[model samples]
Target chain A: MSAAGGLPRTGSALAIWPALRRSGLGPGLLMLAVVTGLNIALQPDFFSGASLSGNIATFAPTILICVAQAVIVLSRELDLSLGAGVSLINCVMASLPQDKVGGPLGVMAIAILVAILLGAVNGLLVAYAGLPSLVATFATGAIWFGLALTIMPQPGGVISDAIGDRYAGTLMGIPVPLLIIAVAMTGWAILARHRSGRRIMAVGSNPQAARDAGIPLRRTKLLAYLVAWILVALGAIAISAQTLSGDPRLGTSYTLASVAAVVIGGISLGGGRGTPWGALVGALVLGLVTNVIYFAGIASSWQEFVKGLVIVAALGFMVLEGQRRA
Target chain B: MAFTRRGFTSAGLGLASVAALGGIKPSQAAAPVTIGLSNGYFGTEWRDQMIDASKTQFAMYENQGLAHKLIVQQAGPDTAAQIQDVRNMIRSRVNVLMIDANSATALTGVIHEAKRAGIPVIAFDQAVTDPYAINVGIDEYDWGKHYAEWIVAQLKGQGRVAVMDGVPGHPAAVARRTAFMDVFAKNPGIKIVWSGYGMWDQAKAQAVMATVLAATPHIDAVCTEDGMGLGIMRAFQAAGRPVPIMTGEAQKSFLLAWKKERDAGHDVHLFARSNPPEIGRTAVGVAVRIAAGRKLKPLPDNTYHYPIKVEVTNDNLDQLLASVADKPDGYFLGEYLSESELDKLFV
Candidate 1:
């Protein structure tokens, strides 16, 4: 899969492929193909308008979280608190005084600001206090959760119509959210080639070495977390947009699931290597796998079990591919 | 690394063990039939309402809903924790066990556990697969069917309808939608332009409705499961169109909406408090009864299913709220339940 690019690709065209294969994307793709075929054979309306839209709409938040998680893992840090951040943002966004968030514009801005602030806190603790990202974020995440539950004991509020109206529809038969993700990917792909981007990779690969090279290690780590949190915030908004209300508990699934997806997408847990694209691909695959399983008329209860299997398969495949390359 | 895992395991086990230790609350000398009441969590006002209702009925003692000793526990939406809680309840040898099973299927073991002890397990809000649980729960099909029935009847069964669904794949959502769709299916005039699960939240209701409005503007009315009915109305209002909206769960929010809308002279109809405090009262009753060696007949086996009364117009809304407030005990009690019904329910 990596061989298409030339030498300027700077590594074995198969450099990324090894991980993709390891991540089980190849196998995942194969299985998905099989599943798709079987599902189509079983149900003709599986690709119908309402069904497809519903699937995409249901999963947009999860996908965005995956992308945010990809960034965090690539920096060789884990934001165990991603879910907490998202949940808090969801609550805050939902609780925005109705008069204030009068439209999508106000809501989006506040949501983005909250994400950045959350990201900054994570970045500051890990970078400045020198706290282990795990402990710091985990503790903060707990606090975040406590706060969320405190705000709205139950689900409340309504998202204004502006969000649901503007972005929910399909453009040329593609979901507007997916289009937004595509644009996000395009911008990220460009950044992936820059020197600072390489620095992020270097820091992920070996922060000590990056520091020796005069790279701004703390700043980079901060940036990465901030970036991740920012995305989380955006993801929260997307979710908020989808729900049109802020559910205090809405982001719980994303907290653990995003990390799982990032690792499954072939991002190293030890950091130093991976791509936003990898996370994006991984998210899509997970989404597809989930949707396919659901639409295939399987008992809906198997979702969690299937999700666990998907994670195991991705981790297993990645290890095998890494070994094969070595 | 291993220590972290071991630590987590131990910490989790400790909370469980401590919870299982039981007898934290005061119990009577007659060993007030040891009772176990498993709640979902203490986070929401709904759960708070249940707790409040339980305490009130317990204090009243008319129906014996209380235990020689009552052990109230929260699973917080965790099926595993709830399962463990049920096990703990059994291990402690509670007389009668009343549980609101986290997930209906997962409670079979706990239900069986209660049964093997000769303890009758009564389920409220949901039925147990164990078949022993007297299910004192609202029928989801009826819950949804009634809401839909109300909307259809109000619209003369001919208006355009947009629906906001509850959490996807929830039995409640499915039953609600299914029964509703069955009714609406009868009337071809009601065009459902937008229908999707809101996952039972205010935001989702708003967003889903917003999208629906975007897709099919100027629709006649909107219907959704409670959780965010007002949220849905708010979304519709924000969009500069206030459609006749129908939903249930007239808890604090809906009650408040009832008051506001009544003052405004705009009819805001809510199908009564769907998560009635009465259900909580019944659940406690069943739990205490089994603990006291009383018969668990009629409550668990037969579903006390009824169409929730719908309150429309400000006057009716005020009247409903007033009645619920004025005669909290008898007025809220499920139809035909006796004073002794609250006997075992008290501790």
Candidate 2:
């Protein structure tokens, strides 16, 4: 059966299968494995239950944001505001009275709604208003950060300790953060099977061709953004749970980090080529690089320089792999 | 990996050098302990100085066999990254954990984790809001009050003041802002003509001050934190406006500027205090004592307020200038509590 807009596809073959086989997932996963091995060598207890859980809790937000950026990049667009969006949602959820909103669940609903609205704003600007996603989202990011600062100027607000404990806790011998990541990946899996998902890739792959093939480019982009922002909202919630408080600048490092993860994940920044799972692996690779650096006892001053060098090496490897494939 | 091997070899070489320098065997009274320092946000010279001072102190401890290792993990201004750094420290089984926190409230969970792992956590430079962590830093509120009070007195309880602050949401900056605003609010005559966040950055402060100078017809005094004082002075100088009475820090650049004004026969009314980065060294000393099982003197709120003792006024400008003359412009002139002074903090 055709997936969308008469795109050729077999009924049994899933869209993600092609994406997984075609993109940078292999190299990204390989990089993650190598880094993990190095980390384990330096830190023998790297995979201890407590250490694993703690590491996953710290990594969940970045991993989710990487997937969020991947979704937008896969649609031939960008959302530079995802990090700021996380900060804004974090402030909103932490500052608002959970009791007034009918407790934790309601607060979460509001956060998700805010995330969708933020994504829709970017979608409308990029898809409907025809503004460059780069410039459009950059402006919106600033606005979101400003709004976040307005909400929580001094980084003091309370989130229930229960939430933080549960986030750091384990469920059925599996870390809660690991479960959250699984849920996100599962969500992406379902989306990859959807008609809108195919349309997003089609639009990103070649907008003119997609238009000729009768795909609603604007709507598809909007849907892509909405999906991506939902993921970001989840990320924001995860981070809030970890922090257990509101800070407007908590997500400041995420924007560039997300973009870097997408590139490292072997997703072409030009668009339409990589899977969110590849981005997931890329995020893990980045996290492990940090772990390895710390465990290796690199000097504080040289840590950043070393991180840069490692990332460049990863990117160079991907380039060489891509060239050989071609 | 080759990198891991090299890291161990260098670490080994460092220990050998420390042993040679010390010229003494490891003490048997207390076993040498590993100390971990997790610092988030390394963008400024102040942070660099803090880390350097901590390393210097750690090496001294290593030489004395109080500490066998000092593992430092410095990351960007991301809470999660810092938390991860702290967790890595815990996993490495450091006997003590010292943190220069990025966010006061955000690190509670991780600090708890460290405590549960039976590691004593000492937060310095910036306090964390965890009950489990012992806070060691200057009283940021009083630090701000000193600046505000001095500025108010110089203005004789009245003047148009332009207030330049550090990062708005930063804990230290927030405390300082609250103190300044409270003092300003109590006084009826002090009018705040302009205010903005300088992000604890000199260039950003300079730009903000230049804009304030352009828009405001007159600012009787500029109340600012350290690190940005020199920039504010330059802003006034560049605009060809007479430099006003201002607050300053112990940074060499600002101190030098104050001296230049005094030499030029310009009476510069400045109050420069030392928010010493050497507190990093002091915190290490405290951590070592705690790890040695020394009980600390009971304190209110589990907080130790390092005294803000060093100040540069018109009175001692020459002496302070001469002391820091050989230092770099970014050098912060201050002192850590000596080992003897730290003894008073423990029972």
Candidate 3:
């Protein structure tokens, strides 16, 4: 790396901005813009205040889960258990007796605490026990799902109509979920600016160099997972507010969804470079795709097929965009 | 075919909520009030029809000085979210809440909360068992018993029978299954070889039927209390097995398939009954009335059992449902919502 006008320059003019072209987040943002714009065009009324607000509201949960996946990936790790983490939270929160269910703060604390504990188990298995993160989290995810099944076999509990209404409601003229996401992203950007965070990124980009540089590899790996778990827990909270109920199967589809979102955003499956905005944009793309397909009046059966096609196109775009610069 | 069983009403209606809780006294001088409604499941057409009838009935009430707003939902079939929606409605202080519960027990607490919030609740399709939640749906036990009786009749009083049940432990499934077995106690000629749990998935039921056919050599008849289980016929068709006699209620498609099977010399009968959506909407109406301060009785029979009108074959299914679907105004708290009934001023 060499500095040109205080900015790193390399390769060709394209390589001069290689970070922009190589950056996974850029294509992901493009996908988001396409999906959102297409949605607006497809259903003129889809841009109505309530509908647009709902778009933002629904995106929060999926974005959170994707970001969680992104963080884990950035640490040369994966946590397939995130969707299961969300499912577990749903069962736990809904199982709370309606009368006995405490306030939002209490329920949120317990949900996050349980999720972190589950995450720690994943960390211990992968970082200390030397099991691969993929297999470890996959197994733990199954166990978590089983636990959710045992906790609330059927949906119940009255999520404080108040909390859901408050958080899901628009503030002034914007969907509150969007506001929350903005706040979360800024905080994440600040964290990414720190030295430890840079080390995590370096560790993701090149594990050998990170090790040679004497990074506390296992601890860094463990913290990445913890952060991921926290995001998964937050995703469940957003979903809970949206649905106002805890459905065991509610989080079932989100596992593949989060992975799809991150990958679509140009995040590498092999683990390395990615960004928070990439995950957010990826989720918005998928969500908009769903809305568009349904608005197109396609049958329910077609939904799966259409989404599958979108994922393929997204991957191709990401790879092409990456190679054109390379 | 005449449909001349003039829709009439008896005085024994829900007197528990409105009259007792409502502070206002009815002097019979007000316009009908409009009530907003929302529900789930679009795959169920009978439910849609039932809702249509409920709206007609509600309109008739408005003609007689009462009204309603219908808004059903399809939220990915997520029940907890639906419950949360209802909770929000209660907080918004809807006069009364009527629900065709997805979970028999799970909704009990929400029903109770609505009641505590000064909104009466009516559990129409599925009972909640909450003391405050009044039950108004079919007598699922009787529903099961009737299905068994029909199956026995199809077998000419005896055969090897099996149950393709709904979701395990579902209130309807339990009631229908238990009533069927209880009814079978008297018909010694019928032997139940296996009870397959299909979870109300059509494809799953078809598969279950295939598995049952493979294992049970003497299975002569198959019965399911839910309309979705008729997939057994499709299962039998696919496997080319001797189609066992099949039965269920209120699905036109099933009845059409049943008629096809019967016409082609297969043994399948339709225990033609109605979906619970009507009961669901009516439960809401009753709750609203309670909140409005009208007097009501402790719902007739403690649990209102919609009549068991069996449409023996295709012709009968059409005939039965036509009467159900084309009523001037569907069955209301007391009678058919007639034009005169429909003529009452707006609420």
Candidate 4:
């Protein structure tokens, strides 16, 4: 699929297919198409207003986290703390004193700052302190989780209606979830066009070479983490809006699931590969798998087994395609 | 992956039949009611049995042509996912919505939306505090209190008791912990030496119990919320200590384990009560009735407490054990009201 990279584009509708396939998004798109087709066939009304919106809304947090993880993964680093960061932000948002200035908005502004600070801490540990990303983030994840539990011992605090409605409502026939997806994609596109983006890829590809070539390795990596945390904070906000309540454990699943989504999106765990678009498709594929399993009347006992098998098979397919390309 | 042509044909036929059924006016006035069960968490064996029992009841109703099949959508432990599961069920226009809520308050907004959509929602197993929905479950606080009373009596009102709780801050966990703590306070002799949260999983309970055992050298009794008692027992066995006077739930595995311990000449005094899985079936029945325009006798708090099945002690252990001898390990040893039995609650 990468063969289309050096070829001149005809700039036609026919050319878009090969271009998408060349970006390593091909396998993810295929999986999404097949799974979504199966879902629509089984439920028939799967694309109807409420069902479609709910599907996207439920999976939007995962999509946002996927991109966040992609940012880190593209730098040959991992941030296991993103999930806990999201959880901490969610709890903080909910537990914001009702009498505080500006109420939820003030709480949200504070949360965004906290997210950036959390990201900066991670960046310092990995880039400045020279700690291995895995162990560093894991420890930070526990710290963040403990902080979240401390902030909201129970999952009971409320988010104001203004913020909740803004996240959950539709606009001009488009679901809020779709809007969130658009924002993430657009944000990534802008980042990819910037110089720091190229530096991140360079660092991931060969850090020593990039350093010798005069790139600021530490700052570029830190920038990637900063951007990733911003997305994660948005993810936390999305989760807060959807549930309209605070949970200390709200984002626990996202930690590993985001990584799973990144790999499934055709991104290499070794890093410096794949696109954010692929991550988007990968998240949608995972979401549809659950819906298809339910609507197809797969027995409850076998549901988890089937889901695992499908994911493994898709991963295998991606591997084979990668090998064929080489 | 099993998207076969015949499956598609049958699905089309099913839709056509549903549409045909929707179009017709039955002289007998039977409406093909669709009930949706949105279960939030599947971490426990109790949930498996609960879903199994509900499905069995739905099948029985379908066989009798009382309703269409129940649409069951199970999600992970995430609150947002479960809320979306409820929304998806609503989108399908299920006549009734039944939930085993992940949180008491997290899904309130979504439940309100379901009610606004003309769907009658019944919260069972995990009752929500939402006023609009029909709440059904065991009185968790009383369940804890009764067991605590038994433990206090077994200890003759004085002992170093260790308490094992379920997920901290969970509504049922909170109620159970409060009731047990209250009961312990009432009995001046009952001193809780160590307390730990077990999250209601067997392995988690076992690990927590091991830690508690390490910290406090001696315990007169172990008071554990059900589902995790078996694990706590395992911790005792692993440590090679005599099993203390313990409170267990009505899980078949625990009953069998208790009997085995008894047969092995271990002097163990245990009491277990029903936190029955059959409540799922009861909730399904209630949802069906409410959707059919039947008026239910309203309780002041909008909550209906189903009867506890059995409280097993040494005297009654043999009978309870024999009743579930042929059942699976995960089965809960309790009874729920049959369909006709549930009918009396309605006007």
Highest lDDT: give the candidate number: 2
Per residue, candidate 4 scores C-alpha lDDT tens digits across B1-347 of 12111211232343333333332112245558789899988857888889888888778767766668688877768776677678767777888889998887778778767865777788998888667777889999999999899999999998999999998878899899999999999999999998879988898899989888887789999999888999999999998889999998788889889999998998879999998888898887777666555556557587889878688898888888788878988788757877667777754
Evaluate model 2 with DockQ and give the value: 0.65
Model 2, global lDDT:
0.84
RMSD in Å for model 3:
9.4
What's the true lDDT of residue B31 in model 3? 30
The better candidate by TM-score, 2 or 3, is 2
Q: Report model 4's interface C-alpha RMSD after superposition on the true interface residues.
A: 2.0
What TM-score does chain B alone reach in each candidate, compared with the true chain B? 0.78, 0.91, 0.74, 0.90
TM-score of 2: 0.90
Q: Which sections of candidate 2 miss by over 4 Å?
A: A1-21, A310-326, B1-31
Residue A136 lDDT, candidate 4, scale 0-100: 99
Off by over 4 Å in 1: A1-43, A171-174, B1-347
Q: Output the worst ten-in-a-row residue range by lDDT, candidate 4 chain A.
A: A299-308
Q: lDDT of model 2 at residue A69? A: 97
Write out the backbone clash pairs for model 4: A1-A22
Cα lDDT tens digits, model 1, B1-347, are 01111211222342333322332222333345556677654555556666666656555553443445556666565443354456556655666666765445545534644554566566777654445566677788877777788888878878877777876545567778898799899988888877887777777777877777777866777777767776777777788875465664565555666577656776655454354646676566545443433332243244445334444444466666665674432233223234554443222
Question: What digit string (tens of lDDT, one per residue) describes model 1 on residues A265-309?
Answer: 677788876667667656656665544553353533455677788
lDDT of 2 by residue, A175-271 (tens): 8889989998998888789988889888888999999999999999999999999999989989999788898988888898888888878777778
Q: iRMS values in order, in angstroms?
A: 15.5, 1.3, 6.7, 2.0
